[model samples]
Target: MSTPTGFMEYQRELPADRDPLERIKDWQEFHKHFSDEQLKTQGARCMDCGTPYCHTGIELAGSVSGCPVNNLIPEWNNLIYRGLWREALDRLHKTNNFPEFTGRVCPAPCEGSCTVGLIGDAVTIKTIEQAIIDRGFDEGWVVPQPPKVRTGKRVAVVGSGPAGMATAAQLNKAGHTVTVYERADRIGGLLTYGIPTMKLEKHVVQRRVDLMEAEGIEFVTNTEIGKDITANELVENFDAVVLCGGSTRARDVQMEGRDLNGVHMAMDYLNGTIKSYLDSNLEDGNYISAKDKNVIVIGGGDTGSDCVATALRHGCKSVTQFGTHAKAPLERDSINNPWPQFPNVYTLDYAHEEAKALFGEDPRAFSVLTKKFVGDGNGNLKELHTVQIERTVDETGRKIYSEIPGTEKVWPADLVFIAVGFEGPETPIIEQLGLAQDKRSNVKARYGKYVTSVDKVFAAGDMRRGQSLVVWAINEGREAAREVDKYLMGASMLP
Candidate 1:
């Protein structure tokens, strides 16, 4: 341990976010990192618990507890405490192929299950992880290490998202010729399009993709299977195929005015915004502008919050987020979601902070469901009809929502964004491959096995696991690549 007094002696501290108003004016990262000395102290705060539940990454009652990739947390923390950043980054990259992405975006479960958090604040693990990778980039320690020898095996990775990127990188490092196919105009799938430039700048993703390209991994954009290219051709040409298509089918609100001109799915709005921003500096009349409009974003998840932030950037008049469930408590509620596990507590992201600053109040409305949407005569959405409901467990042990009879109300809204969630991967590619799908409509694959019903075909990421965070997608991709490499070579050394 770095500190002689151990974990309780030191305290938890993180970098502050930029001014909310200033950050809302542009699409750029608002978070600032801690200084080197501060990071070292934060690292010293880790107790290096005997059990080290942070890296266990296990499911204890239907929920994941720690880092899914089983990162060597304590070892890296100690390394950082000693200012051994290069070594810490080495350990980090050993388990995670893309720490730069995860370090920035991941909802760090490792910190949630932290032993220190039970009594005191959790260790600043996420900040340290980001610092290590940033140092690696700054010190020129992170370079592409191409395999000295080629195995002559060819692999096709469909979808250039995190899953396909990780799989291709690992497979290429294992001496296989890997080619990633992306249907979009660019590689990096959601990283390039779905995610806004504010939270995760697109250049960061491009830099990593460039490095992967230098390592001899081929990226082919604007080429889709079963349409532009055939799945049969892929199976016949390549030794193996890994499907990484994400869950893109947006869960929409089924209401009367959903067909109105101003109503749109969250993905379409965000994707269009990112695409237009990337296409040319968000030119006038660029795709999906929300200028001077009253925007009502339905749903309470990250996507809904993103819509709020994006609308603010576009200078929307107002923003509101609707949630079916009641507001979460600020502190941990063990009976609902126990400790040493992901706490379902209230935490505000960048978007919500901006909304609070500009709108003079939080934009969240809980326990309210949109019954129908109101639209103007010109086919543009105008408002929303909603009602509050009480959540209770009904007979047969199922959660039921009961509407309050007199709670119906209407709110003004010019643009309505449906940001509920995703159902599953788009069916075109799945149907093209004729892959077996689970009841949830995800590509069928055993959790650890990752092997599909068909031979020489593997599935991973959102396509296999359904909608999840980028970190989980990367882990699934890496693990799936290992399984695919083993299947092809009958015993591989690449990790």
Candidate 2:
């Protein structure tokens, strides 16, 4: 409680983003910074409730309700309000190993469960969070602090994403030798490539990686387990193994003309664009180009939105995103989507904002299903055939989508990117390690205890829990490290 009436005294505010039209011309991050006074004002909006749900980190109604990393929200908020940014940064790092990444990419369930939001708007927790970490970096407060001592034990983390990075960081803190292996040419699996640069610049990721490296964590890139090196070899070489390889098999739309030249997976397009952009600033001409082409992105998730943004940067003539679900309400539906759960409300995300700025309308088309790809004479995608759908509940309370009559339509599409989400972890490593899998094909490791059927083997992150947010991945990674520490030593001190 910085002030008794602080929450009422201040209205919620966030830093304005760069103009969508102007930002679309370059790949730089679009978010601007707020002044210190503005950030302190935003920080004061925290209510600091007696029973604050902001840090509960629990799942409600099948979605996360609060901060998954169990961030000490109120403590940091008060510190910021008192003009103690150094203290605020320290408190923020107590739970989250990588606030910079989450601050930029996370959806901020913490805001949704804020006590202030129940009455009015939530505190700008995300904005303040980013500000704290950014200031920490600017002031040179963040630095590599390697473990003071070394244990005889060694641990190998498979994957260099958030989960794997967190696991390595914690285990190293416990005095164990840590080695992280990334199959990609670069470190930071999803963060390095899967995410677009406008949301999170690659340099930010590299900066953290450099610090981790300086802290004595060895990162091996361009090498994969179960392929370049045998999984058995990894199990034999390391005292303990933690699998954090994310669910990477992108789901495909099994429709007619699927093999057409212009039909591609969303990840493929995104990955290629990023790789080329980073490699030569897009001068290599190695990625799929949308210039002078009409693009249609299927599946309306973050990946789909990313595809839309990437297309816009490539100078696409037009773009449209397809979603099977109905458009969300302008506000939360109190009856079906009560407070404390993530609000299913409508707002223009960055990609949609950019699309609208250029195309004069939002690119998303809700409650639409793609029938098939219509190709040109030479096996190139020319157009997409789709129909409007209506949702209904069946006798057994199962939701079903039925096509509407006389609503069939075709739209020109020079390229089609499928962003329907992922299936599970690719089978090579799972099969090679002989790890048991859940019904969903994810690694069969319990949430809190990340033990696998194979002795001394563990799993976490999207590989264990299926596709999820970055915050959840960090949560699992930290928890898995604690369990691994307990297994290695008689007791564990990791929190």
Top-lDDT candidate index: 2
User: Candidate 2 on 340-395: residue-level lDDT in tens?
Assistant: 99999999999999999898999999999999898888998889899999999999
Pick out the ten consecutive residues of candidate 2 with the lowest summed lDDT: 39-48
Tens digits of per-residue lDDT, candidate 1, 1-495, equal 778665767778889999999998888988988998898899998887889888888877666788988888888999998989889999999998888887888889999899888987888988899889989999999998889999999999999999999999999999999999998998898888877777788888998999999999999989988799888788889999999988888887776877988888988899988888888878845678788999988898888888999999999998899989898899998787877878888877788889999988888899998999877888888888999999899788788999999999999998888999999988876787788999999999997678988888899999998898888888899989999999999997866
List residue ranges in candidate 2 displaced over 4 A: none
Q: Candidate 1: where are CA atoms >4 Å away? A: 4-6
Give the C-alpha lDDT of model 1.
Answer: 0.88
Each candidate: RMSD: 1.2, 0.7
lDDT of 1 at 466: 88
- Return the lDDT, model 1, position 205: 94
lDDT score for residue 482 of model 1:
90
Q: List the pairs of residues colliding in candidate 1.
A: none
